[model samples]
Target chain A: MVGSDVFRAKFFSLYLPLTLYLVFLLFPFYWMLIVSFKPTNDLFDMKFSPFWIQQFTLENYLYLFQNTDFITWLKNTLIVSIVSTILSLVCSIFIGYALARLRFPGSNFLGLGIFLAYLVPPTLLFLPLAQVISELGLNNTYWALILTYPTQLIPFASWLLMGYFRTIPKEIEESAMADGCSRIQILFRMVLPLSVPGLLSAGIFCFTLCWNEFLYALIFMSSGSMKTIPVGTVSDLIKADTLFWGALMASAVLGSFPIAFIYSFFVKHYVSGLTAGAVKG
Target chain B: MAANARLKSFSMRDFFDRERNLGIMLFMAYPFFLGIWLSLTDSMIGRAGQFIGLRNFVDLLTDTIFHQTAKNTFIYALVTVPFKAMLGLGLALILNRHMRFSSPVRAAVMMPWIVPTALSSLGWFMIFDPVFSPISWLFRNMGLISKNINFLGDPILAISSVCWANIWRGVPFFGITILAGLQSVPQELHEAAAIDGASVWHRFRHVTIPSIKGVVLIASLLSIIWTFADFQLIYILTKGGPANETHIFGTYTYQIGLQATEIGMGAAISLYMFPILAVFAILLLIYLRKEQ
Candidate 1:
């Protein structure tokens, strides 16, 4: 009688609520997975059960590969994300060290200014940036996004790194200075090696952010070949008169696959970075 | 020779500061000031016009669509933030428990957030399809309604659908951050409160809420700023469609600035988001300083 009661209590309190939440959360992805594999006949058919697949097909994936500029968009997205993330990480490390350890005039004010810069939303800047990019003759090119993304990325990566830098003991740097180590040498040798976790998490975030960015990509890269995945998938796949549901979902699944795969491995570091940045404030 | 020696002494600090500052100027400050100037003019795509100070703002004031958009933006933030806070807090508490398969469960909750908003929103678009919707099919089979419901057809339903998608995307961020805060709260505090004969509600109200207050404040403030300036969900899901009822500042600015080629008016519209965000940023700065 006691064991049965305990089982019922656990079922109601823990298992039931968690199950509901998971269903609510995962059902859309499940739906996308199912619809992407269904043939056009079953996709549009009213009689078929949307929950269960009547038949399986790889037609949508093949169509996405052959019938579109999917490969080019994928390549464009990877290049933009990787290059910008590397640029931001390098800039952030130097600035973050300056503000965190070096005693300089106006450092606190500069730190605050950097954080405030992150608050300037892209929606407010994209219009003026459109003109600025054109005047520089970077319009409809990869350089537009590469140059503009740093405005958001540097502030964020710098702030997160500044917090991480503060947590490392100052005695290590002081001893390095005593041992005739130059400031740059100390940073590259000791500080950089110790904060590898911080660098990884910040880089992961910056890369994912560049991949997910849409507004700037939409505005800057108008040519079909130059477009990133988010912009291309949204603009090219969905036509005005005809909607290709299977191929569209297939693209979404494939586009989100890289970030999802990366995130599953680094969730702990990602979570730590998130709290360290936010709570350390 | 003396000047060169002095330059060598100051070079490191000056170089670091100048390098970072120049990047900020080129990327952030320049665009910001230019946006201000653009809002003051009558510029269009590929053509520059004479300066017209505050005329665009005055004109937007008289435009009815602008008024509707202002209202919609506020509605989006107001409805979504509070719900995200509540649901996120609930999720944190549940996940904080010692449970079976904890890590996988946590990963499952974060999937919506991990995926790109532009793409995951496409999944939502299909779910809300007018015909052949799984939701509609389920509802009809359960005898809840006699006919198919158009999720995006009606103006009110369209905005509601957009808000729902925002909430779904936002809650995981709030949950994960708050979960970090929860873990930092000492386990002894809750256990001590329980030993004092406090009810479950009392223990949570007294012990839990106060400890996590700072985290909650910071998370919600950031969420509010992002939510107010949100773009992707509304853009992909509705495109301010069904007679432009779902338009917010982001989408409306995109339409006027890019689509309509009224760059000046679009800059003016985008500037409206700045003052509201500035207020929250101030509060966040103050809170951060106090915590330190």
Candidate 2:
């Protein structure tokens, strides 16, 4: 081990810069929280320490609840995210299992194909996807987002889960198979339980991606009442007409809160899953 | 190994085995093939979109605005990608070492990545707001400049402002992933290097970097793809404005495709990104397989 002297040197050199970077990273959330709570007067006034929420008020949330379709957007986002995440997880788990365990024909290229499919970003696909959505008669509907989202989400979650399943001992399945237990039984009874952490990680990732998607949501959902949280909040004309800064910030806070909560609480899983899925991709 | 023997006996996986290839084919069919086909047609504004045989691609190539957007996207990637890579690696190095309260500090550092970017972008845009911007207020009181900076309004600031937000949103993932990379380098090597009186910079250059070089490359390529195609941060902050100066492939495609009803050109604009991103994706896949 390095001497304590060296450790101290490392600490000194690292902390100040780390703290500065931490501040930069956390500032937006802090600012959003402060602005969300601060009264419009304190928000506008230079006298207020931009850092502090001097005149704390619920007026922004109140206005958001009372005047806008914030609740509707929230619900729409919830339904779409939940459905898409579930679909992605189921498909990803099967795909991951097939690639990891089955050793079926073309599994290698199939994995490569999934990896390549993932690289096709939504920004690139939305135009053609928009045409597809319209042709399918799914335009301006929740089904459009729910259907198209998995095209992106599955590649990520499946790749991560594939890495996960490969790490599980093949011996376990071998013994179970020798015992004459079916492969499906071995997978459902043995493998699924072991991969919960991975599943959770992939689930959170799918949920986050679904929650955060903007382009497809904007393109596919056009009606005011049909929009998910991001598209509804950003594209809607309320802020255009009134420029409701307080309500806008409040909406931002609420819009971000669910995934942010899950993300912070389960950060370990999130990081590992991301690196495993992405770096391991 | 025994499973490999027994699996051939039963073919138990035959039922679900097709899903992987099937799922992959379905996923590929739309985006890769159908998308390319869509780019070849002029499907817009209630038309059946007949095949125009690369007219859309030619139109976009010849269009000045498309040329400008491509230039801006390249410039934006150049400006943001390096800052993200360096800051991420720097923080990762710092965080990799043992320290007091390191976990919480690292957690805080990663909060921005946790927050949905579109929402957090609103928070930044608020701070960058012209009339009541906290940044402008802070700048005013510093006695450095007497004016509130038009962060999203001025062309220069708009580009840099979006870059700043993009960097803010991006750096944490790189930091955390690179930190993960840093942690993997065995302590024995560092201790041995120290015994030889290898200087800090020398040990880092020779030992630490090479150990995590794969991670750094992977992280940077990922950041490059992310930043290149990103729409949320730029769209939220600037919407390709102060007169479309900030428009990248993502936002520019949205503007022309949906707004102007020029779906074919929009598809072509998006398709232009394929070659560059495909290169990155291929490089990334090679690195990923190496990691495994």
Candidate 3:
């Protein structure tokens, strides 16, 4: 009885701190959700009510959709993120396979270079890149972001795919080559099928990254139609005289849903991918 | 005929190899080479300016804004990295055990990371606003303070406000990464320590610390990089306002380059971030090699 009591005490002691930390982490999100539903007047009222929704309404969501350019921003974000992910996956796969399987003169250096490039923060590179983007005459267009974002995505995807491709046994590819299958065929037929989880994780990561990216969207694309969600949301906020708390939170909740869904759906793979890069590094 | 065919095949292989080399060179040419080329010249504003050698570098050394921005970035990074690491480690230690509803709690903790930073900053901005701050209301209601507190209005508090937003967004990264690390440590170590009458602190220090050192190092390095380069959080929340006290390198570069169109100086300031990031990257690479 005493031993069981001790175990329970220890367990509770360990569990309490984690629970509190989670509360702190999750409170703002919960507050956002509650504020999204609350009427505008109640949202500002200095009442300490927790669950009392004085007047529940979907008017904020309606305002976001009907009264603003939220939909256009969503569409633009989807296009850039999706295209960037697909393009990055294709480039990383070929490069990753080559670096993993083929022994070439500068292959090691190339692999290391890609990893180093991944480490170069976009904050540093964006200024020089802005000049390059302007020179290409792609400023204020979605294509500017579509093209420049790959510079950031490719390096990390290549690094991740290289690590993943290395984990697949060489004998599988070797046997395919022994059967007179070309390297391309082996990659398409043998290697890619085995690395789908890694590819999915990379795709989700790239997609979420491009979706959430703010600086480039703010700088590279200036027009309303071209603005992605992050930049667009902020611009909308700036234009408002009063804090549109309900509408802002509503849009935020909606904007975050897709990535949240992707994260929830692929929770295990995402965790593994993060750890594979993080813990291994 | 066979010897001639073999020679032809060898030549073809060599040609393919050269073509592949050229392809990679072409791929990397823009970012690797073009960036350096632009940095050297002073033709950032228009097409007609000539290459003035190292003038931008010299200007950067003497610029007060550059010095202040660098100081802000270092302070931001130095303050946030260790705090987030410790908080994350503490949370992971607490949550690593078998418990009811652990998965749900884990998911809940990860929601902040999943939410977009701009959106979250906006949310926090409202929460910090003097007019609608629930925190101020709560404090007032409890008689802790007689007036509403403007968290983002003061200079030091403005920096702390941005830090709070960053910490909120960043703590999850440490939690998730450290949780993964904690899971990898064998349960037997803890059990053996317990059987040998070792305290929880001993087991944590001797067992958990060594086991997860690589992860801790990598996660901290990554946090340092991200925090140093972070702009969206500060940009939306404070806009580097309250007397430019919160302007880090990222926001400063954006302000100069994009907003003010001081392209050459902006490019110089932005490029300055490379050396610091390179050191972290080198350490990360060494750690990766040792792990392998």
TM-score leader:
1
Best by DockQ: 2
B64-137 per-residue lDDT for model 1 (tens digits): 99998999998898778889988889888888888987877887799898888999999999999897679999
lDDT of 2 at B93: 79
* Overall lDDT per candidate, in order of appearance: 0.87, 0.81, 0.78
lDDT of candidate 3 over B1-292, digit per residue (tens)? 4433332243323223557535544544555455566666765466534577778878888987778778888878868888888888887777686778766667677777877888778778877787777788778888999988988899888888888878888888897898899888899988998999999789989989998887888888888887888888889878887777788889988887667776666676777887888887888888788878
Compose the digit string of candidate 2's lDDT tens values, residues A218-249.
87888888888888778762367567777888
What's the lDDT for residue B89 in model 3?
88
- Which residue runs does candidate 1 get wrong by more than 4 Å? B1-15
Give, for candidate 1 chain B, the lowest lDDT window spanning 10 residues.
Answer: B1-10
Residue clash pairs of candidate 2: none
Give candidate 2 misplaced runs (Cα > 4 Å). Answer: A1-11, B8-13, B17-20, B289-292
Restricting to chain A, the TM-score for each candidate equals: 0.96, 0.92, 0.93
Select the stronger candidate by TM-score from 1 and 2: 1
Stronger candidate by TM-score (1 vs 3): 1
In candidate 1, which residue pairs get closer than 3 Å at backbone N, Cα or C atoms, i.e. clash? none
Candidates in descending TM-score order: 1, 2, 3
lDDT tens per residue, model 1, A164-262: 888888877776666677778878999999998889988998999999999999999999889999899999998987888999999999998898888
Give me the chain B TM-score of candidate 1.
0.93
Cα lDDT tens digits, model 3, A1-281, are 99999878975787667667867887777767778888898865656463357788999899888988999999999999999889888877877767666666666787787777677777877776777778789988878988878778888887778778888887676666656776667778888899888898888888988988888888888887788888887888466577788888888778877877778777778777776543552
Task: Please provide, for model 2 over B140-234, each residue's C-alpha lDDT reduced to its tens digit, 9 standing for 90 to 100.
Answer: 88887798889899998888888888888878888988987877789999999999999989999999989888988888887888778888888
